[model samples]
Target chain A: MTPRSVLVAILAGRPNAGKTSLLMHLTGSPQRPINFAGTSVERVESRVVVEGTELQVVDLPGIGSLSALTRDEQEAIGFLQNRAAQGSERTVLCVVLDAVKLSVELRLLAQLSGLGLPLLVALTKNDVARASGRPVDATELERCLGVPVLEVNALTGAGVAALRQAILRRAETGRPMPLDIDPAAVAARVQPGSAAPARSLTDRIDAVLLHPLLGLPAVGLVLLAVFQLLFTGADPLIKLIEAGQAALAAWTVQQVPAGALQSLLVDGLIKGLGAILAFVPQIVLLMTLVTVLEASGYMARAAFVLDRALSSVGLSGRSFVSLVSSFACAVPGILSTRIIDNERDRLATIAVAPLMSCSARLPVYVLLIGAFFPPRYAALVLLLLYGLGIALAALVAGVLRRTLLRGGHSALLMELPEYQRPSRRVVVGQVWTALREFLVRAGTVIFAASLVVWLLSYYPRPAHIHAHYEARRAEVVAADPTAQKAALLELDRQEQAAYLEQSYLARAGKALQPVFAPAGFDWRITVGILAAFPARELIIPTLGILYSVGEVAADSYELGSLAQPGASGEGLRARLRSAVDAQGRPVFSTLTALALMVFFALCSQCMGTLATIGRETRSLRWPIFTFTYMTALAWVCAVLVFQIGSALGLGPART
Target chain B: MSHQETTLDCLPPGAVASVVRVEGEDQIARRLGDLGFWAGTLVEVVRRAPLGDPTQYGLRGYRLALRRVEARRVVVRPGQVP
Candidate 1:
């Protein structure tokens, strides 16, 4: 069929008007989010074939009116205007309206009707409206607006089929009619009672959730629960994924010959894949909770509850959602900033989001804490690292608002949608979308990065280094046959360490070592830090390789001293603990570890996050600014921590 | 009966009022108008946020949260609670 036979049905509505839910029902497919040209505003489009005619349903960013207020709203208006100009015969605008809030929503409907596009009304939440004694009569609405109106319950799938059929039919055969009815007048004439019940279910729920005395604490508890689940609840799943990856890597080693290809496949590709997969559990958990919160309409209340506190930092309540999402992963968090209407607030939120200590940083913190601090203090240090991230994020956001993003008064005008059961399909769809985007990044950017790192560490294998190790192995074999296997293993480790000492990565790390000397990091630690730029979790494995400990699972660093013999990651901790510099000075001290943790906590190391920031802001400038500022701040903090701790006799020399 | 006029921010929780007009030509004022805060629209102060800065208002069958700064721009005539 020609492309012209395909019909495009644009679902337009205000926020929380159930347009997304309705679109999901209509298409019977997961929505694909696409960025509009030259804008970061994402719109979801899904296609369904009905009766041999293709129908494309596009869910626009929700807006209050054609007179746009926010960037996304302007995007929606621009899109509609473009469609109108392009000749709207093949396009039908399906206006989704909340049956309970028809008066205000109808203002949008009225505005769209004036566009003279083929129109249809999908009145949602009829059940709630009817139960509240304010049911919208679809027949009366259809008569009044001179358009076919269908009442749809997206949750139960009631009336959805009829609505889909109506949309398709309207797109094919309907023509725009001049409608002269004022939305306010029509709403007043149809639904006369200007008063709603003093306490609806949502109101009652909000009464408790938004209680002046209890709301803040309630929000705190909710956030605590989310974080608890994200870190602890997903621990076992993360461990399971790590174990699976380790097993797969071991199996690959057994199947492949010992060569560069084997190392690349196991250490580079599989390890990178494992790093990507390791974050899935936490991201999935976080996104599921976030989607549920958003869908149930409690997110707005949480924003409201925190607005006053956040406003002190030049952020509105809306920034809280993005920041919280960043706690899981900054990629999704940056993407979610579209919901914030104010451009200045959105940019400020995006600027500080990466500082929220995402799950990727957990491995680095665990490795450093396990290596440096005592077991009892591990928890405290971890908490301090997380706190450092948050405190810095707040400070950075406040500073950004006062400087780069200053002077725009962000007025918080948000709709508190009626609380409903989070739609199962919608939640799953959202989680899937987040997972898909993350996996795509891992496959492309992470994969390429891992390959580049592998090449750097693997190449220039000088024959003399291998010959030296082979001679040592031969001498050990001749000297003692019984311990030949163990002796060869030692020689192999020495040979790998020797080879890496002169490799390009190590040379670069050494070149940059002086820059990081104030932070107490040696060449090896500098190399690990440099390698982790693409993904923060790579630091552990890179450190494992740098110390000649071989490939270690990113999560296994946590099992430090308690690890069983032959555990892959246990060797790295012991090596790092006893490792010394050229002058026989200890390479890593408690102060060094603290400085390193602080550096990791603040540095904008993740290329994925930077790319996402660039994409979201639609500019290279913001991402560059984010990188420069974060890196500079990290260096300053790391140096300060190192210098201050050293002066206070908190170094390895004192301990 | 005398008609009393005041900004929406001055209204107490549960006070019902009809909007007179959004007083400014700024984006926030136009946004308020877009959200059905135009003239003659009945709005109720549903509740205040926990910190009491942005307040929730019931208008046109939906609850909207507006900070005091934005609310201060909407002139309203207080009416008797039904």
Candidate 2:
């Protein structure tokens, strides 16, 4: 009935010392954020009960020396100097060091030794150093620093048991060894740290990743690979879900007494809900990839690459990581601005992060890109769209920082972790969690939102109004062989979508059609976009409904296929092709696609992202501003791109 | 060069340097190494990783790691290249 004594082990280290890798190995499987009571940085903690003692080992932020420059580094030092600061109050310090680079680390150890508190040195990356012919004498090093030093191969599970025992031994001791390191010596090393050396392998990696030429393309390539994988891998699963949804709808209609209730459940709820639910697989895939990237050292490098660039936009490079968090959902991403430590930078970062084109945007982008762009240019168009998002984010961020949130933005004082191969297990777990979250959202916000949109679109359904529809349905359902046979020719035409003029979604689309006409989007796209507001992936379902989805053979092009403009130019496909500007030429050209992608990527249309901003800031001002500005930006950008591009012979020149 | 001997630059990473300066800017640094570079103290670079940066050095019966970039920022004179 008693809780085990939770021993807190705080692992402190210099950058590139493989601290996280060691912690990952120490705490196997399903690692959660180890949140300290009051701090934003989760002191990476994992608890394990031993000998009736519950011990929590935290991988603290890497600090070069007790004398650090950045705020986080200072916090790390303060935590070590005063255990109460990290909230453990009784936490033990486990000084993690790269054996290959000991002398500098010893300074830290020496400082810890003086503290008189229980301290153990985890000499990590022994495998790496030993392979590279740089091995340290652990015993001698321990003797030299007057602290227990254990060799650990963080990559492999070597020496972990020893390290654990050492930690447990300290926890059992439960007494502080007062430190006595001369503070003067620590300060003498560097004159009041202006910042940790801004030049290191960390920043050098940024030089390439942040380069405009390679940066955008590299991002595009990574995104293309990830989405292509999602598109291909999720296809089979989506089909299964689609089949089930259809079967449920059919059964529901049979159970109902062929009245308004059946229509509401089947037409309004089923179609709209199905559209939103269908994107679960893609979201899971994205979350999985993101988790792996974050666990590996590459994500840190990404932040480093974007830091200077973000700074130019009145945001910190540290904001880059928070923005990346949006790919999962906007709530956490916006909340992650806490790490920014600067109000101006955090606000600016929050506003633009939604424009990074979160994974929710993935569904809409994929659908549009597949539908409009040629099959061969599928991935390229998708890539362009993502690129457009980043570009718009930069532009918007720059303007906001300069205009609204004016003043000096905090620069990125980052720790560049060494790159490592992503752990497959961690990624799998992340994917599982993301999938669970998506499903949960489906039943909550997305589900309710779907029902509402469905209700709005389904209500006031045109029943027995149109001559062609009323005449056709009467003849087909007459139950007489001659009546059905005579109506078969018209049956195909009736099924071709004469029913949409009767459905609820159609009317809503009709009302919104003129709004998007200037952008060359027809009623179908406008309806789809509206339905997708709650969940971007639901756009496909809205399109299916608008296009009279049921009769379209699932295996064939169905309602999802890219409908190109035919020579005749009459159908929905022709409308897409005939989207012309003032000069009367194709408007949806290559440049137009790029521009649309930019608009979509940067637009603040997602309700969830805005909701998240509102929640995090505890104010509607940010979300409202974010929404208005992004929409205006998207509209202007799209119009300019289409109009200018058409003039330069890019899109359909006439509307 | 006279006042620099007691500074971090006077004691660089690789070669042993007789600390000519010892005035520390803050307590954090002093607690790590010395109260600053001590005029009589000795420092020497012991090892560096493959990247040839973030070099470790031996001094005052303990080792300290300073990135090469940080070292360049610290002016040091070689007493004896160890």
Best by DockQ: 1
RMSD (Å) of each candidate, 1 decimal: 2.5, 8.0
Backbone clash pairs for candidate 1 read none
Candidate 1 lDDT by residue in tens digits, A1-655: 4554688899999888888888888989888877644444556799998877788899888888777766678788888887787777778999998888787778778788878789899998888888887777778888888789998997887898998889878876656866776778787666656333224888888889999899999999999999887877788888899889989989998999988989899878998788778888889999999999999998999999999988888787988888898998998888788778788988988999999999889888877777777778887888898899888888988998898898886888899988989989889988988888777754467667877887887778888988887888888988998968877877787788787787888889999999998888999999998888778878887788677776664545653332343345556777788888778878888899899999999998888788778777889999999999999999999999999998898866732
Each model's DockQ score: 0.66, 0.09
**Lowest summed-lDDT stretch of 10 residues in model 1 chain A?**
A558-567
Question: Model 2 residue A94 lDDT?
Answer: 83
lDDT of every predicted structure (CA atoms): 0.83, 0.58
lDDT of 2 at A313: 64
- Cand. 1 Cα-lDDT: 0.83
Over A65-151, each residue of candidate 2 has an lDDT whose tens digit, in order, gives 565544456567666666644333446778887654444555566665655557778887555445434455666565545557788
